[model samples]
Target: MHPMLNIAVRAARAAGNLIARNIGQQDTFEVATKNKDDLVTSIDKQCEKVIVDTLLKSFRDHGIIAEEGGVQGNPDSEYQWIIDPIDGTTNFVQGIPHCAVSIALRHNGKTEIGVVFDPMANEMFTAARGSGAFLNGRRIRVGSRDSLDGAIIGTAFPTRYRDRMHAYLELFSRLISNCADVRRMGAASLDLCYVACGRFDGYLEQGLKAWDFSAGDLILREAGGIVTDFMGEPNYVKSGNVVSGNPKVLRALLQVCDVQNLPAILK
Candidate 1:
């Protein structure tokens, strides 16, 4: 393992444990609404602080872009650490056990290290650029399912776009008719990691932040999954619109949902 990735794995695992220990008990800690659909607990803030503090102490010069703490560390540096202490806040608050703590380190604009740890399942998915992906020290890969008809797909709800919900519903309807099944897992990072491990064959979403998918997408790609914008363009890294699965299934998805001006999940 690369030295930095080892550090990220440890940091993410530590944060995951911190979050897991405080799950259902969070209702009494304190809750804040980032929006109607988005919720954050006092634990979330604490977890981010722990994650950021640990990383900065080790690599004090690397920049950090996080969900709760915003940006911290040296912004002028070439390296960046992206952190999402709790990816599925609602799930965690409701004791659903589907959220995760994700961390990604970018070097010169390319994500070089990624970690997504689900303490509930003890599944730690890690990846390094060009090195491939792993879960619990074992290699993992995207599903080889050739077509959407046999694919188990996943999606997420828009956080603040009720008016766009109908568009989301229509897309879900189309995918449901052709795919073997559709799941809305609430945690985008976990959903993408599941796709990498073949738990789900593919995943799409509408409206996501950089911290939400940056690490997960790189992990998926390193796991041999293909990632792209819904329109079939290679726009995922910056646009935030991401479609991921095996190459065959990804291209097939592009043919189906690659509509012009369609609402992109990551955008």
Candidate 2:
């Protein structure tokens, strides 16, 4: 593993273990609402602190962008660690056993390493820029589904941006009509990792944060998948709306989004 990637994996595993131990022990933790319906838990804060501390211990000059803690460390540093300590806080809070700890390292605005660790499942998805993606130390790849037909795609609802719900439903309806099935798994990081490991053929969702998909995006790309915004631009990080799959399935998904004529906010 690349040296930086090794550090990322270590940090992610630490946070993941913290999350796993807290499952079904919600009474021991506290929960709060942020951005209306979005949830954050005390466990989330604890995990973020663990991850940020670990990363900074190794590279204190690097910057940090965390979901709960916001930006920290040297703001002008060329290296930044993007973190979502618990990608499925709701699932973790409810004892659903489906949350993950996501960490990514970016150098000069380009992602160099990604790690998404599901402590409940003990699954570690990892990737370095040029290295292939891996799940539990084994190489992983996207499914070879040629198109949307008969493909099992994954997604998450636009719970944060309710105004875009109608547009999402239209896309969902079109997708369900053509695919084998669709799943709303509640965690965007795991949804993308599922795509990387061929558990799902494609994945899409709107109203996500950089910390939500940054790691998973690198994993999927390293696993031979393509990701873009609804407009077919490599701007999902800025738009917070993402569509990803193997190349053919991705093109098909873009067509469905185009047909919907989604509002400007979603694009």
Among all candidates shown, the one with the greatest TM-score: 2
Candidate 1's residue-wise lDDT over 71-149, tens digit each? 8999989999999999988888888988899999999899999999998888899999999999998999988899998
lDDT of 1 at 185: 87
Error of 1 at 186 (Å): 0.8
> What are the runs in model 1 whose C-alpha is more than 4 Å off?
261-267
RMSD over all Cα atoms, model 2: 1.2
For model 2 the local lDDT of residue 180 reads 94
How much lDDT does candidate 2 score?
Answer: 0.90
| Full-model lDDT for every candidate | 0.86, 0.90
TM-scores, all candidates, are 0.95, 0.97
Q: Report per-prediction Cα RMSD to one decimal.
A: 1.6, 1.2
Per-residue lDDT of 1-267 in model 2, one digit per residue for the tens?
Answer: 898989988998898888988986878999889978789988899999999999999998999999999999998999999999999888898899898999998999999899999999999999999999999999999999998889998987777777877877877888899899999888899999999999999998887889999999999999999999888899888978899999999999888777447673464
